[model samples]
Target: MSELTTLARPYAVAVYKRAKETGTADKWSDALAFVTLLMQDEQLAKAAANPKANREQFSEAFLGLCKDHLDTEAQNFVRLLIRNRRLDLVKYIAELFNQYKAEDEGYIEVDVSTAFPLKDAEQARLSSVLERVLEKKARLRVDVDPTLIGGVYIKAGDRVIDASIRGQVERLAKRLWT
Candidate 1:
């Protein structure tokens, strides 16, 4: 995972910089997503790995698969990826591009794992508190996990707040075992 991220970072950064400069982050987001999906096709992967595949032919086929979804800029981006033989990195590029777009839009996406579903009022209060604490617009994605036992597990970027009952019990067990 880390290796893929490291390899994809430069491409993601370059594309993001171009999109940021041209005010087309949203467009690039859609383009990258589309291309990423296309690259996931088994036939496409086989063609990409074929040493005999002509670059022009591969690029045209890729662009054709996309139909009218991509614009000229996006078409050129696809061609560049083909020329560089980096279609395998498209997924990571799209992920990083979305991350960049969220940061630009002042959005912080967080995941919340709770033992039970949250009520409307509870969700609202949690969002409000998270927004205040994170100092960015909080977008919460909640999941019910019975194994959590109680409380919540909140993850935002590299930070994780594991206040779940299972987490506490595990910590206590570890201390006692040590």
Candidate 2:
């Protein structure tokens, strides 16, 4: 995981820079998503790895698959990836690029896991509190986990606040044993 992330960092940075300069972060996001999906297709992987495949052949096949979705700049980006044999890195590159873009835009992707489904009012209140605490716009993705017993666990980037009853019980048991 770390190695893939290391290999992907430079590509992500370069793409982010270009996107920032051209005001096309959203476009790049869509392009990267398309490429990432293409990379996931088994047939495409076989084609990409074929010993007989040349850059032109690969690019033609790839572009043909994406012709309807990508613009010229996106096509050039795909060509560059093919030329550099970096098509395999598309997923990691897209993930890292989105991370960078989110940071640049002062937005945080947060995961909130609750014991049960959240009502609209509850979700709105949580969002309000999170926005205030994080001091930025919060893009919250919520999930339900009955095993949590009660309360919620919130993860924002590298920070995690585990307020679930299950978590508290585990911590208390550990303290008692120690």
Score each candidate by Cα lDDT.
0.89, 0.90
Q: Using alpha carbons, what is the TM-score of model 2?
A: 0.77
lDDT (0-100) at residue 87 of candidate 2?
82
Model 2 lDDT per residue over 1-178, tens place:
8898899899899999999999999999999998899899998988776767898988998899999989998898888878888788889999899889989999988899999999999998999999999898888899999999999999987789999999999999999999
Tens digits of per-residue lDDT for model 1, 1-178: 8798888899899999999999999889998988888878899888987778999998888889886889898888788878988788889989888788889899988899999999989999999999999999988999999999999999987789999999999999999999
Name the lDDT value of residue 118 in candidate 2: 97
Alpha-carbon runs more than 4 Å astray in model 1:
39-55, 143-151, 165-173
User: Any idea how many clashes model 2 has?
Assistant: 0
Query: Cα miss at 105, model 2 (Å)?
Result: 1.7
Per-model TM-score versus the true fold: 0.76, 0.77
